[model samples]
Target: MIKIPSKRKRGVIISGQGWQRLQQAKRKMEMQGNAGESYTLEELSKITRLSSNTITKVQRRKFPVDKQTLESFFKSFNLTLIDSDYAEAIDAPPPVNRERIVLGGQIPLDSLLYVERPPVESLCYEAIVQPGALIRIKAPKQMGKTSLMARVLQQAREQNIRTVTLSFQLADTQVFLKLDRFLRWLCAIASSQLGLPKRISESWDNIFGSNYNATYYFENYLLREMDSDLVLALDEVDEVFHYPEITADFLGLLRAWHEKSRYGDGGSVLWQKLRIIIVHSTEVCVSLPVNQSPFNVGLSVELPEFTLEQVQDLSERHGLKWKVDEVERLMALVSGNPYLTQLALYHLSNEEITLDELLKTAIAEDGIYGSHLQQQLWRLRRYPELLADLQRVVLSPSPLEVEPIQALKLQSLGVVRVQNQRVSPRCELYARYFKLALAIT
Candidate 1:
């Protein structure tokens, strides 16, 4: 017997027990029908007649969905919706709770902490609808690039577009050893993500070469089979920068694809169905011809640091009644860095420490940022040239110039900001911490 809540709201959240029950049912169905493999979002959408974004919302449970949505979701598995399965969504607490807030990685889709950068999100949303759109989002690590990219994909999904995200971070070292192996890995993973069988062995050809074969697989198999336009997001693309051997080739392929869509390559319409979003932290380190580079062509977005007003807005979201002065004080040390600002507010909201104490210990080993500082220190130590250049910038009273590549790499690390070929420490905290850690006089 199931009971419905007397008062129904437009949105509901799944309870833990209900989620577990649904997962079990889904898995059982997968075993019976999908060869023991989990269904992809597209398949699930077809079964439930819900948009993939809606299905994702149900699974993440971070946002609310209509009660009727859950009923349809449950009905697909032949299960009845019960009162225990969900609770009406009420006004939830601000995302200041340490457990609820995602401190690292992409912010959850339902989070209140994500502040829109206005025209940036709007521009991306508009560009993604155009055929063969290439969106390049370049930002230092932890700068909310991934979060923004997620939002773009969410919008596409809501419009019944297919979205696939592939992170280079997931690739193993050996995958980069040969172009063929890397292409095969890429194709196979994409196939699995789309709930398609691994047909790489049959589709790949030694005679045609890896690049062509990879392109063929996508053109004839993946895109042709898809019912909706595909938004393929490749994240952490900087990982490929270290591998110069395949850098030119792989990036050139993307360029060619973009061109194909624009010019009707071979008069095939399939190429137009793909929209690509590439997220990298730094400029390309390897040399690529301007004509062969995807970076040169497309919608480029460079994420700027939060403005003072944005910082104040974020602080308020974290439940801090910070005035302009308090916000400015924090910015003096962090300079509107998004992750740093959010973490600071999270701590302040807990009343764990005063703003004064936080500022004083910010660069200290026992402070909230001690581990983060150490990690940056470790990365610097690995590259003697970067470490040496950063020491110069930190110790000098004025900004210094370093090798262009070194400046880009350091900026990517979020330790320095480069302007007009001059490099300076990103903030007071970075200067103080690295000056001490690097034994600079």
Candidate 2:
């Protein structure tokens, strides 16, 4: 009788070290020979004389490819393929709920599922070490803004620097009623995070304005108390944007601190010890001079959606051996939205749903994305103007040009995409879901 091999032994995947070596070689080649631009899948396919699917499989290490395919990929990059670089593919283990909580919110620091967006992580890590650096991370909801912020804070901690993270979402409505109350709350929160006493109230002066008092508190107390540099990460800054009364003043105050770090006539040394990380979900709609706006200054990081390759990488990390076509089919509906992709993979990894079943019920109320889509619908219902504008975009046969402010707001909400002042539904799922949700008869 002839012996047959098991399914797990039928193919091979590149090891972690192998993937790193291969990526480094590819990046070096891109820099030296390709004008530093990353080669697209098509460009890579042409160079390797392999199908794009095979290249993706070799690079992503999700689905296994033939040994000859790996050898070809290695040869194209001028590297030799070795046995240690590849391993026999193993069947994925069953999912554990404790480790695979992909419902929503920031991914944990040590989670294998957190896929880096390349230069973005490197940029944030580098920016935080500079004196008085202000790094702004902007993206729509669930685009991993907070997750990135958490990593940045971790990076700061690794450098032996002090770090504090405060989200405006945690602030009470009464806190925004007055600028003084808000500033005091900020200082108090930072103090607590830093293990300092709430001394702001003791030093508070009604005679001086809120901005002045807040600056004085930070410069004199917070900075003086810190042994190393301080990283003040402010998340959900868009909450502050809702209140025009304190938005300009608070942002201007941050700008002032940034400017003081570089151009302070006398206090530059004291202010230099401070670094600010601002994370927001929307564009700054309020008007302010260029010099006074912190949004334009500093290392601005705008988080983008995942690409097809990144989605594949994430799927592999989830222990799902998804093929290129399956990934494309999923992306066709969600278009690489990070949260949606992760949620889909989470369920699939748990063996709860099939891809066919998922696609069919995607827009239904009881689907995996049901609550998420309902949240978006509720948000739109709150703003009639935005609701009407979105309805027009979804109902139209093509992209529509709405009011510029409306376009900005809608794009920020992640409901639509705006390019060259024209707006369209963000994905086919959004279009189909919202068309029914909004009752666009």
The top-ranked prediction according to lDDT is 2
Per-residue lDDT of 310 in model 2: 82
| Per-residue alpha-carbon lDDT of candidate 1 for residues 1-441, written as tens digits (9 for 90 to 100) | 854445334599887557656766877788899887657556788999998658767866667898999999999998999999887886444344344567778998877677666446656776787888999999988899999999889867755788889999999998887888988988988888888888888888899998999999999899988998999899998888888898888999889888888784564478889999999998887788889999988899888899887787678767888889999999999997888888888888888888999998998888988988888898877778788889889999999889888999999998999999999999998999989989842
**CA lDDT of each candidate?**
0.84, 0.86
| 209-304 per-residue lDDT for model 2 (tens digits) | 899999999988999878899999999999999999899999999999999999756789888889999998888888999989998889999888
Please give each candidate's TM-score: 0.80, 0.81
Clash count, one per candidate: 0, 0
Candidate 2 residue 392 Cα shift, in angstroms, is 0.4
Lowest summed-lDDT stretch of 10 residues in model 1?
91-100
